[model samples]
Target: MSDKAYDDRNNLGGRVRRYARVGGSVGGLAARLAGDRLFGMKIDRDDHAMELAQALGNLKGPVMKVAQILSTIPDALPKEYAQELAQLQAAAPSMGWTFVKRRMRTELGEGWRDRFASFDREASAAASLGQVHKATDTAGHALAVKLQYPDMGAAVEADLNQLDWMLSLFRRYDKSVDTSQIREELAERLREELDYALEARHIALYRHMLADEPTVHVPAVYPDLSAGRLLTMEWLDGTPLMRFTDADQETRNTIARNLFRAWYVPFHRYGVIHGDPHLGNYAARDDLSINLLDFGCVRVFPPRFCGGVIDLYKALRDGDEALAVAAYEAWGFHNLSRELVETLNIWASFLYSPLMEDKPRLINPADNPGQYGAETATKVHKKLKELGPVTPPREFVFMDRAALGLGGVFLRLGATLNWHQLFHDIVGDFSVEALAARQNQALAAAGMEGTVDGR
Candidate 1:
């Protein structure tokens, strides 16, 4: 091969090697955590786990992003794993100037100087996979540039392999629980999430889908600056969702309404779901509109599934077991025996409790026994043990995550609203056929031309 060809091969080989190294580290860390927990092995579980999580967090690549996703979505990992991975949320170490410059030069041309009026070397925010920097284009449009770390796909795949091993260890440790569904769910979404180009398009799709919803915001994409690894968009300014406590009741309610639309308008109205529910993904502007960020984990479901969701809500409210069963079956639960069905109802009831009630939504601890969250987890584990493994068809994973993520935000705001009524208003005209038609139209317009049958 020529010298240039040899250099290209060598660079590719280096990337593969680095990915393997990180993958190996992930497996090693899981083993260490397991040994400490299981055998009463003289290991400081907290300190050691924190160290391992920090190491991955420091990497700030695909592995770290996966960890962050697992952290926020409860039951994706066992309790200890979730606890450790949760740290990755705010804990990812930012990339330094050296790496940032290298990445920018590669993404833009070496003379890419003319593209931007100014680009900040320092990152404004850092997370598991990439970092965002505030910049100004030559056209003077203030923008946020999300730059992926080089070779994130390789890192993600390697880490996922390690994560599979880690989940197997978890199953061994807790035989009562089968996490096959969670594993499948995370794996599929993580793959889609690794593509920044897909994410960029997701933003554009949302912009058009939610065009009339003033309370929710989606940033304008700059296609000229985006690629599979990099994204540039209009920078949105807002306070973090966590800061809602400082706002008053009306402000909180307004924020919640926007947040409600931010989360459900796509799924309920357009059949697309923003899968990542981390509190960081949304913000409340001074104008009271909710600004959504991070489109990497979008999950587009069959419109039938959304209709099934609404039907399920109606069933729970009317105490119609048959309707509930139809909805669950529609959502892809197979060979669901009567016992399994009943067991599921216990869990479903908790999830749909807000929608079932005639009163306004109040996520107060006083309202729930805190029993549903933990106890339902235990019950599901027991059922999985006895009734054979259950795989929660791929689509529900992110829907569940988004719901909890939004719930967490609501809990933070301590805002109460008539959730049942709002839900009814959205789905009152509920027809799976209509939803499918609208969704198909939206997807076609966005160049995502395909039909999604519930099956």
Candidate 2:
């Protein structure tokens, strides 16, 4: 390989290029913020936001990860930026065959092509950390080949540095929720996603946890062909979720039910959740069942945290303030005043309303399609503004991200369900110790190091 064949992302030159790309992309927004704050000039957030988003979309890296999570959090970014950033596709166009050849040789040796019956030179799918190519093994079994982008480790750190600056500016403008915890958590998850080895383990864990879930499918990992930066797995087939958005009501409802189970069964039973619920992470099958595609962003919660989620649900249903307080504390929220708790409960009520009702119904019936949680989020923002700063525990960020992301999917499907029964069945048999045991057992079975009792 030539010296310049692969970008030296850890070198000074690479760092300069990345930072320059990022700054050039969003410099206008930074200028707007600076002008609005320093020069006493008015700058609308909506101005050039789409162009800014388009600029970011043209590249793939940390900004996309940060923006994806921020989109799930209400009012984290100005509405225009959030909307535009949400539209940023997670994947960039696939790197060309030259890059692929170099990457394949690095991971699988010079004879890499001979290991497969045939490997597509073009990427079938691309995303922030890596792109996937469809291939077949020597035996002709279908496979998905995931190859990490070069120097992603360095790229992630560089992007996080830039993220720190942007987040600080955001804090300067709006201090409604202290996002330090959220930012740090996102950094950890994004770096973790760069590790295909860890992600392969996550895939194993999910397959084990959802073994009984006939409606959900998990792909099998191929250790022989997988490495720290490359992952090979069974190529599962399904349709992207958007294809089902305009389907018949029955079909949509069935798909929604399957999705809910796919997401929550892991959490309610094993204390693990698929942290990333972007539309690209899932696909629908002919039978209305769904395949969970991406396992790179899984989160394993403490058992006490899982218990607290149940406690909060019961408190909300029974109107028990004492239980609610305990739940909040268990979640690591400190310095909560009565008014603050009440303010938090206002948002909680809206999230839990669907499940509180026994009858089957749309997740957000009164609102128009694609408008799920818009009104409630605005109300929550207003209440939080009035009640003063409420620091969200780090755990809440991903939980809320996955929850809200799934809710958006439900809205897109227009699915109706007896959410109350679904909630009851999951929580009825729940025990803190049992969940801890289940979590530990599942992690151990998958060769993962996790103890639910660990802090």
Candidate 3:
């Protein structure tokens, strides 16, 4: 491997440093939980959960990202933990210019500054894994240069170990949702996010999937200036989606429609999804169009899984028990009992409720937009506990996450629309065979053939 590539991997020193940091921050919670479990001592879960969130929040990398993801999934973590972790943002403090200069030099050599007409010393934005710097290319075009933080491979490995321990501890206390598959799925995606070259391909794949989508924008990547740890792409000018939350109803609805198309059209047609639907991942233009950012957490699904999503929706809508069973089976759920199916349906119906109604309505009529799915999630969690453990298909992790994430966004916007018709407009003629064919064409066109199991 190249020296530059070696620098990104989990070196001995980096791994040690990461472990020390994570363990130092969270070791107290681990000891406390262990005491509670072994000695039958009672501890204030809410307070401990907050302490754990604060601990992870202070750390950088996939641990924080994993915490945020777990917070959204129902029963993945205890309610108190989820509530506190949900407050953790995808962002972190930016690295200094000295660090940025060294990173740029590592990515593009010592003369890296000459490639740009002008590059900002300060990062325009920062996130868990990387930070974005605004710059002007030699030809005077605007660009966003995303530089991956150093030793992320070590960080990811360390954080994933911590994640497994945390989940295992939770499992010892509660057996509602089996998190083994969730850990594996998150590990694969988190590792993938460390590779900017793979992310560049994801960007290409998204561009191919949404080429005809005029209302949604995907930035064009600059191959010459990009590297495994660095990505340079066309700069998209837009405002944060949250900024429009207080806008007029019509404006909010238009933005909502565009956001819906941007997220679903790719999944419905190409069998791929942008799994991280965090508000910061997208921005809205004055024209109401959205700029979809951060290609790292994308999921390219098997064609059958895509069909299964639609099948389950129809099964719930038409009250077909057998079809629901088949749909769940298609999604990799097996040996499901009648009671389990009924239990699963409670959550399914809640998700499909918005899509079932033909008239315009709010995504959730709840007064507190932030608590949109909390109650339903709690109900489902209770049922799952009674039904025993269910190992959710790995694919279901992000699919459910995206749904909940978008639902929260819609609730925040207070956008009203005929969701049933909007959903029908995309899946009116849905077929697994056609979807597979389209997915293959798009993947091939984007030079991502075999990178994902299109079948």
Off by over 4 Å in 2: 1-11, 366-371, 451-455
**Which residue pairs come into collision in candidate 1?**
none
lDDT of 1 by residue, 217-304 (tens): 8999898887656799999998887777667888888888778777777888788888766568888788989889888888888876
Candidate 3: tens digits of C-alpha lDDT, residues 328-381: 988888789999999889889999999999999998787876566788889989
> In terms of TM-score, which candidate is stronger, 2 or 3?
3
Task: List the candidate 1 regions with Cα displacement exceeding 4 Å.
Answer: 1-29, 32-56, 71-76, 173-178, 364-372, 451-455
Best by TM-score: 3
Candidate 2 local distance difference test against the native? 0.82
| lDDT top scorer | 3
Error of 2 at 244 (Å): 0.9
Of 1 and 3, the candidate ranking higher by TM-score: 3
lDDT of each structure?
A: 0.72, 0.82, 0.89
* Candidate 2: tens digits of C-alpha lDDT, residues 1-455: 56254653466666767788787777767777767766788866676667767777887776777777786677676666676676666888778888888888878889988999999988999988889999999999999999888767667777788888877877786778788888878988887888788899899899999999999999999999987778999999999998888889899989888899999899999889998785688898888899999999989999888888888889999999999999999888999888888877877887888889999998876464334556676777777777777788888889877887788778877788998888777777899889887888899989897434454
Candidate 1 CA-lDDT value: 0.72
- Residue pairs that clash (backbone atoms under 3 angstroms), model 2: none
